[model samples]
Target chain A: MDYIRVILTIFWKDILAERRTREILSAMLVFALVVILLFVFAFDLSPETRRNTAAGVIWVTLCFSGTIGLNRTLSVEKDRGGIDGLMLAPADRTALFFGKALTNWVYMLLTALFVVPIYSLFNNTNLFSFTLLGVIMLGTFGYIVTGTLLSSLSLQLRSREMLLPVLLFPVVIPLLLSAIRATSILLEGGSQTELNTWLVLLFSYDLIFLAISVMVFDKIIED
Target chain B: MRNSTKTSLMLIVVDILAASLILTALFMVFYYAPVEVEMGLVQKIFYFHVAAAWTGMLGFLVALAAGIGLLRSGNMKWDIAGVAGVEIGLVFISLSTIMGSIWARPIWNTWWTWDPRLSTALIMMLIYFAYLLLRNGVEEPGRRARFSAVYAIVGFVSVPLTFLSIRLFRTIHPVIIGSSDPAATGVFEMSTRMTHTFMISLVAFSVLFVALFWHRVRLGVKLALFEQRKMEDFTGED
Candidate 1:
């Protein structure tokens, strides 16, 4: 209960702060839209092809914008001297990990909420399936679960914004591959077995990395 | 610095051994092994190519252990080992990729394909390369080691998952160890002579990887010491 309360406090603080500025959320939304726009131009994302190409485009957009959101979320804390204050507080450090991850997870889902509709509208293809949205949600959860830790790890490094993506992209290749593939199957419709493979892979990824990050995150953020 | 000369002497001995073994393996690969029937001379690349890729993977595995060692012990010595393993891994893996690419050109009639093994090799390269870049991004030595160690573990764990996801898609890369894929372009069975050459190449590469790991660790130590001394001597002078 204490751990949960501490995590919620930090999560609440982040949400309140973000609500005021909406900087991270807005940035992610706009960036995601632009990436979709780029994909529209670069690839023939007509109604027929949208099923195959849109899955990758959407995930890539989420990843890139998610990177931006992750960097800023941490930098905002560092810039405001919130990190030292948080450290001094009488809370379990891992609570802070959950707090940050939870917040990023929200922002990422919010970004996805916006991108999916816009994509469906532009392509004239219905992407409003419950399963597709569920896949998006699951994939986003895994991405942020892994990204939150990495963004924190890379946060303290020089040229951190530049460093974050390079640090992150390789580590999440599996997650990205699974997410894109899973979404494609949901959109285009595929064999239940293949979908099961990717969804299980995605779930295991979320679980495995979430455990690893919680164990080691304190090392990165510790004084 | 006290044991620098002694260590250098050891490095020289191992270096000589590695060089000679590789030379013998090279001779056996070309001269002793029968010319591959289907691919002829081009198939010769398979020996060193696989060896380099194996050594590269061995280096990364060493780094994973070094990473764990550093986290558990808080020893910076393990940091040197971690960096050295990754550095050597990076070089060798990149060589393996290029060599594999060249082999693909003739054998697969394409410069590249996203077969599970090939893509996995590429992702492995990127992951370790990012490991090196992460090291460069942190100014504090202890923190850098800790961060990179964390990442090395993370990166190492993700690779197999990456492999599994891609493998599920379908692999056209040859599986020489197990049953080969029929759809795979360049599958081959090794004759006795070729197997002998391949085994020798593997041995040669293992020795070379170990020797290089030690040498790289030594060089890392020297570089760290030099940097520390230089930092100490600096007094904010122009």
Candidate 2:
């Protein structure tokens, strides 16, 4: 019950701040839309040509915009001493992880939500499939699980803004690649078997890192 | 200070053993390994190629273990060992990757193929290269050790997943002679003498790896001590 409260409190905190500023979400949404526009011009992708290429463009946009929000979100905490205050709280460390992860997940998903409608309007293609949304959830789960921890660590470093992506992109390639591949399968209208294998892999990855970070995060966060 | 001579002696013996085994393995590969009528001399490269990769994997796994050990125990020496293992692993894996490429060029008809295993090996190499870069960016010893240890452990865990995911992707490279598939792609039969030579090469390379790792560890220890002693000298603390 207490853990649930902490998570909700943290989630509410992030939401209120974002509501006040509207900076992070706006930047992420615009960035994602521009990327879609770039994809149209760069590939000469007509509506007819967009179906096959849509999944890749959407994922790429999410990854880039998601990274921007992640960096800014954590930087806000660090700058305002909010992270230090959270550390002083007498609760479990994993709660903090869950809280941050939940909020970041929300930010990424919300970005995707906006991106999808804009993409559909611009490209005139439907991306509202159940299977594709499932892929996004699982993929974004894996991505943010690693990204939240990485962004926290990168915030401590000197070249933080630049370092987060460098430290992250290579390590998280398995998630991104698997997710993209799995998403591609769903977008192609393939059966569950084709999607099941990669989904299983993503589930296992999320489990492994979730456990590891929960255990070791206290160590990393120690002064 | 007194251990330097003994360490050097051990390194020499290991190097000599590695040299003999490599030469004998080459001779047996040419004469006794029984080249396939298909791949001819090119297939001979597979023995050392696989061995180097295995050894590199061994080095990486140990480094990861040492990194975790350092973090848990807070022992500076384990941190040194972790760094040494990663450096040597990086070197051997580089050799393995280059040799794999050379072998692949003739066999696969290209300098590189997105063959799953080979691609994983290349990506793993890049991950550690970033590992070294991370270490370089940190100035404080304690912080560097802690951060690098965390990275090594996380990075190592991700390696197998990366390889498995790629292998799951699609594989075109043939399983070699001694691997599981008897009728696998690029498969061939090996004679007794060739087996003997390959075993010797494995043993020799194992010795060489230990020798190199130990020397590198010693260098790390000495450097740490040097930094500490320099700090003490400046402070006039006995």
Candidate 3:
């Protein structure tokens, strides 16, 4: 379908651009590393404390670094007038939203992929579980679904840099709370019963936000 | 001219009613309602605290409706209503949070807890604070209205989620009128007089919310007109 192609075209364009510049990924990765390092010195937790708190630390780092990637994802388009160019393309605007959100979601997952192993090695706690990774993916998807839409809105503002997180963080609290809880439960070796509610919360958040972002993205992008 | 006078007269009547009702509600809270035995006089904060929280939620619902209105009709009046609702919502939510904190200090023995209701209320406040900031960051009125309306629409999705997540996950905050939870530290059974006072206070605050929102919308309309006139003058000079 043309819609699928349009979405993929936008997605591939971002991929190609990032593959050439590597700007967003590099910044997000470095920011993730620094946040983790700062957490190390700030908390100075013992092994037991570290085990319990590792999930919180990782999610927080991902959230902070994820903001960087999101800011870049849209600001880059706005800075170069790429959004106007994309708008000129005869495609549904929702496709553009899906494309951008998908790209941001990928960037977030890639950052997590790198951050998780390094965090595990440094903290001496295994965080590479499938369940935790699943939570990260769902959480990151929900966050980016909202984030990409908000970043687009913020990019049109004078205070785009500061506005994105202010707009995004408060709205994403449900996703964050559920994600953190699920991750903590996995880290503590909790059974499925404890994780079920959180997983449902994350799924519902993703669905709700994805639907809203698609519906409202057109209004924000209008000239 | 006659229509303007009529509208102003209605507003004045509403203002007088709001004032008297608020005074009566305060009297009922202090003099009429039974003093709570467990927490003593400090428990009196619950009357206004709950009232303010309900008003804040009502304001947000108004904002959400106005947001949808703007998107549907593309009218600046709807945008004006949207901003007014958010502004008033922010004020009452902030009041509720602070009063809840003060009440918590004595009852829960801590100034703060990660109680679901309290945390969600704080998050709701932060979302609207961001809404205000988002509006400030735009200079163009039309674009600003569009962006803020869209943000309000998107932002409202969080309210229900925040409430549900808190209710589902864990809560130590008191559920005032519901099934008794033994773990809820602040649960209190209300006598008939107390219930009457609470209902009156809720009604009074709802009227206050409407009055404040109307005034704010009027101010927004005037500001928009003034800005348009200023732009026209600048264009004329050019």
Best by lDDT: 3
Q: Each predicted complex: what DockQ?
A: 0.79, 0.56, 0.83
Q: Order of all candidates by lDDT, from best down to worst? A: 3, 1, 2
Residue runs of model 3 more than 4 Å from their true location after superposition: B161-166
Across A62-93, the per-residue lDDT of candidate 2 in tens digits comes to 99898998898878988998989988877887
Using DockQ, give the best candidate's number.
Answer: 3
Model 2: residues with Cα > 4 Å off, grouped in runs? A46-49, B1-4, B162-169, B177-185, B230-238
lDDT of each: 0.85, 0.78, 0.87
Per-residue lDDT for A101-212 in model 1, tens only? 8888888888888998998898776787888878888888888878889999888888767888887887788788889998988888789999998899889888988888
- Give the poorly placed runs of model 1, Cα more than 4 Å off: B1-6, B161-169, B235-238
iRMS per model, in Å, is: 1.0, 1.4, 0.9
Model 2, docking class? medium
Which scores higher on DockQ, 2 or 3? 3
Tens-digit lDDT track of model 1 for B86-156: 88888988888899899899888899987777777778888888888888888878898999889988888
Instruction: Give the distance in Å from residue A41's predicted Cα in candidate 2 to where it truly belongs.
Output: 2.5
Worst 10 residues of 2 chain B by lDDT: B176-185
**Order of candidate numbers by TM-score, starting with the best:** 3, 1, 2
Better of 1 and 2 by DockQ: 1
Give the alpha carbon lDDT tens digit for every residue of B18-60 in model 2: 7777777777767777665787888777778767776787788
